[model samples]
Target: MTAVVEKIHRGRKFDQVLQGARTVFLRDGYERASVDDIAREAGVSKATLYAYFPDKRLLFLEIALTECTRQTEQAAAEVEDDRPAREVLLEAAQKIAEFKLSDFGLQMYRIAVSEAEKFPQIGRAFYETGPQAGCGLLCNYLRQAVDRGELVIEDLDLAANQFVELCKAGLFNERLLGVDRKTTAKAIEKTAKAAVEMFMARYGAKVDA
Candidate 1:
C-alpha cells in the first residue's frame, strides 16, 4: 500500500486542497475539472495547489482513496453483525448501490479506467482500496453467516465479489455510460433487494426463501 503512496509538497493548505478537489471533482468530474477550478474552489493560489499536489491525478487519487475508506466505514458502522444475515446483507447491498451511483463513485471509476493505461498505479490502487477492500468486508460478514448456518457459501471470496457486482446491476451501467444523470431512489431500493435475494438464493441455509 505504501509503495503507491504519492509524494507531495504537503503544507498548511493540504486539507484545503483536498476539500477543494473533492468539490470540483464531484461537480465537474475527472476530465472536466481543471487545476484552476480546484484552486478557485479551495480558495488557494495555483502555486499553493501545485505545492501540495504536483499532478491532478494524484489529487484525485487521494480524494478517491479517502472516499473509499469512508464508504467502507459507512457500511461497517451501520451494519450490526449481531443481526440476521438477511438484514446485514440488505444494508450492505443498499450501501453499495448508493456508492456506485453516487457522483463521486462514478467519476472516480471513470478517471481510474481512463488513466490506468498511462498511470497503472492509479487503477491498481483505486481497485485495491475500493472494490477489493469492499469485497474483504463482505467476506468477513459472509463467513460469519456461514458459521451461524445462515448461509451455505463454499467460496466466501467469490461470493463476496459476486454480491458486490449484484448490488450494481440496475442503474449502475446507465449512470456510468452517461445514459442517466439522476437515478431514482425506487430503482436503487429495488436493485438492493434483488441483489440480496439472489445472493440468498445461492447462499442461504437458514434464511427464508
Candidate 2:
C-alpha cells in the first residue's frame, strides 16, 4: 500500500504572514512596503508567502478582513448589562469607539480608506465584516430587548443601522483623516452617552414632557 501524505493545516502560518505584513505596511506605508520584506519578517520564503496569498493586494485585504472581524466580534461580545436599552447602546458605542481607535485598528482603517480606490475590496470587506456584522449583532440584541419590553423599537434592523451610524459620526470621521487626533476614553464614554440619549429621545420606551 502507498503511504499517504498528511495534510498540513496552515492556519498558524498564515497568521504569522498577516502580522508580518501588518508590520511592514505600518513601518513603510503601503506604497513603499515590498513583498520581500513581508516574507522575511514572516520568517517564510517568497514562494511560501505566494502560496498563502496570490499577491500583495490580496494579502492586505486578508489583513483588513481579519482585523475587522476581530474588533467587531469583540464589540458584539462585550455589549452587556441589565441597563436600559438606551444605556446599553451607549456602552456598546463606547466599546466600539475604543476598538476603532486602537493602533492596529487605526492602521487598518487608513489602509482601507486611503487605498480604497486602489483596493476597493479592502474597504468593502471592512464594511461588510466590521460595521455590518456589528449592526447585525446589535439588531439581534435589540430584538431580544424588545421581546423583554425594554426599547419600544418597531424595526430592529433599521434601528441597529441607525445606532451604528450615530456612533460612527463621532468616531469614524476623525479616524479617516489620519489627523493628529485620538479618541480619549472619556470622550468615547461621552459620545456613547450622547448616542443613547439621542436615540432614546427619538425611540425610547419613555419620553419626558
**Candidate topping TM-score:** 1
Task: State every prediction's TM-score relative to the real structure.
Answer: 0.91, 0.75
Q: What's each prediction's clash count?
A: 0, 0
Model 2 misplaced regions, further than 4 Å:
1-12, 23-34, 81-83, 113-124, 207-209
**RMSD (Å) per prediction:** 2.2, 6.2
lDDT of 2 by residue, 1-209 (tens): 11011121245577798899989986886668899999999999888887777777667766767766776677667767466676677778777667777655676666667767775655666777867887888888888787776778888788988887776565667765656377677777777778778888777666468
Residue ranges of candidate 1 with Cα displaced over 4 Å: 1-7, 206-209
| Model 1 C-alpha lDDT per residue in residues 84-124, reported as the tens digit of each score | 99888888888889888998888788888898899888788
Q: Which candidate is the best by lDDT?
A: 1
Output the TM-score of candidate 1.
0.91
